[model samples]
Target chain A: MNSVLTIDSAIVDAIVAHARRDHPDEACGVVAGAIGSDLPTRHIAMDNAARSMTFYEFDSMEHLRVWREMDDSDEEPVVIYHSHTATEAYPSRTDVSFAGEPGAHYLLVSTREPDSEEIRSFRIVDGVVTEEKVNIVDATVDA
Target chain B: MAIEVRVPTILRSYTGGSKIVEGAGDTLSGLLDDLDAKHSGLKGRLITPEGGLHRFVNIYVNDEDVRFLGALDAKLNDGDSITILPAVAGGALGFAAAAAFFGR
Candidate 1:
């Protein structure tokens, strides 16, 4: 599978905003896209049920509902994103171990620094985390 | 009649390379017990001898982490999805470091 993630600029901004807003606490969410297209279009910022600074867990019912909706719409989570309040934009050991989607890109945004935010994407499969290319494009250029 | 448990690639060895398997139980722990019967060595990877979920292992019931619910006792229903994965962290590497690892 291609390891690169192509996302909308607006979505990136929204994710960053959410991360900043949740500062000190980790923010988690998902971006859904047309099945097999790999083009992320829908952004769904999820509730970190854990509400812990060091960990994040999506609300169970909400996750089920969102996943089912995506299934009905013939879409899938293209990107699974979360923020690191004081750490770097990287999947922690727990993150790597919890990554269940071999097809989804795991995006991490570090809000540790007030002036500069670090964002990165990766593909975590079989316990290995591999960084991927992130290309941001305008959302209005679609045919 | 059975809940679908999605297996991660790393743990597929115990499942005979199957990505999805059926386990019968009303709670997360029960299901794992059922899975243990069929796929030996799998439960050990997920549950510690202390009966708690392995710290590095995260089990999600319908996309929610079981740890937040009831851990091993989380309730389950038929058709509910369970996903098991191993946690690992990455992303702090600079472009050069990532390139060295991913060779991109």
Candidate 2:
């Protein structure tokens, strides 16, 4: 797997917007791309079933629908993102223990600061968390 | 009765990279046992040592969550389809807080 996440700047903006909108409650979603393709193209914002400021869970039925859609489209969840309402942009013990997608980029957005946000990404596999670089590319610019 | 079971990416290792595997049983628990016989250790991943569904693993029978269908006791048919998915969950809560909240 690549050591960095190269995502569109627009998707970053959308994720930040989602975090801000959910504010005290954690927001969660996924960015899907073609299977085996590290590139993320589709941003899907999911409901936080827990709806707690300190926790987030994708609704089960929604997760099923999203997974089915991705299966039909030959896409995989390239990025799985959630917000930390009162902490830094890092995966906590809970996140590590529940990290099931070995190939996904686990993105954490911290909305603790009222005026600014912190964004970071990591690859969590087998209970190991390895931080990765996030490369935001301009949509209109050529890669 | 042959039933098709869809394995998620993480659990694909247990299925030997096979996305879909076939098993036969009259109930969800029995079906898991049947698959475990061929796949080896696959059943432990879905069911805990206490014989309950793992908290983070989700199993569905024909699009309906097995939790609502008597979980392990859920009845199965000859051609029913089963899909297994790991729950997508986490939080900013620290280990202690998370354990307390989840009753773990």
Candidate 3:
């Protein structure tokens, strides 16, 4: 049995496109969807906060809500995605120390360099982190 | 085998777009020094001019982050992989937690 990562091109693209769309500053949001086993990864959209774009801080309740929805749907929180407008695509100390959520993959999109798409993914657990490749596929969302 | 330091996209320009680099050092700081030798500005980005890893940047030895260990001095095995991650996500949940607590 292989644990292959399934991601929608539309989903990851929407996130990366959001970052590129709002270039020169960080763009971020939570990916709400069921993870694994033929789930559409659907009804998934980027949640925008009015606070700021240069940086994003997920709302705990929102975070909890997403997790609960995934659980209720028999899904797992697959990935946590973010963009770096001015910095590299690695996990910052804040990212590692404050992950709070385990087993979920962290995806970083780089928008600092324009005219090209720069994105990377990682699996972080118990402070031991490993890199994973992003597989983008076109996904159909259930409205 | 050498410890492979995975470079993030934001810091790649320092290494001329080189993503992975090898170091023969046994400590995280030593690896940084080796990287700095090849890419000078990298050290400035990861650490302050004062030689401290910026609050936003983190170095991980294999799966164990150096911060929880000895930080820069954290020991590494021959096959360890060091990952550099930067924190720049939006809507950090910290403020949200405070708002929820005070019902603000």
Candidate 4:
């Protein structure tokens, strides 16, 4: 697997918007893509069941439905994202412990600053966190 | 007594890369035991050492969370479909303390 996340700029904007919109409360969501494609094509904003500024958990039922839909579509969550309202864009101890999807890109968006945002991505597997490069490409450009 | 169990990507290693597997039991706990017999270590990932459901793992029976249905004692029908998913949870806060506070 490549150690970089090449996603559409539009998706990145949407994610940032979601994070900012839900500021003061952690926002979480998933970007799914065709299985083994390593390309994120769909953005799904999910509810933070915890709804706490310090924590985020996807609503269990919503998680089930989205996961089932992905299964039916032969897709996987390429990017699992959550915002940190007060901290930097890095995985915390809690995030690492719950990093179950080894193949996914764990994207962290820190909305700590009102006028700016910090975005980073990582791969957490077996309790190890490896930061990866994020390559935002224009959607209108063909690869 | 055939129940179809849908395995998540992370847990598919135990299922030999098969997304769906079959098991038999009258209760959710019994079904997990049955699966462990075949998959070996599968139950360990879903159930904690204390035999309770792992907080990070979520098991649903026919779209209903087993946690609300007596957890391990939840009844299972022959045609019931079981879906195992790792809960997507975390935060910037100290999770050890957060977990204790939330009783998760």
Cα displacement (angstroms), candidate 2, residue B72, comes to: 0.8
User: Model 1 reproduces what portion of true contacts?
Assistant: 0.13
Candidate 3, residues A40-84, lDDT tens digits: the string is 364343443433444555443344355446657767555677776
Model 2 docking grade: high
Per-residue alpha-carbon lDDT of candidate 1 for residues A1-143, written as tens digits (9 for 90 to 100): 88688888899999999999987888899999999999888889998776767767676567667766887899988889999888888787667656777789999999999998898999988879899999988873231
State TM-scores per candidate: 0.70, 0.96, 0.49, 0.96
What local lDDT does model 1 show for residue B51? 78
- Candidate 4 interface RMSD, angstroms, 1 decimal: 0.8
lDDT of 2 at A133: 99
> Model 4: residues >4 Å from true position, as ranges?
A140-143, B101-104
Model 2: per-residue lDDT, tens digit, B1-104?
A: 99999998899998889999999999999999999999999999998898988877889999898989999999999999999998899998887777666542
| C-alpha lDDT (0 to 100) for residue A43 of candidate 3 | 32
Of candidates 3 and 2, the better by lDDT: 2
The C-alpha stretches of model 1 lying farther than 4 A from their native spots are A140-143, B1-21, B25-30, B39-42, B54-104
True-vs-predicted CA distance for residue A121, candidate 3, Å: 0.5
**Worst 10-residue lDDT window, candidate 4 chain A:** A134-143
**Model 2 misplaced stretches (Cα beyond 4 Å):** A140-143, B99-104
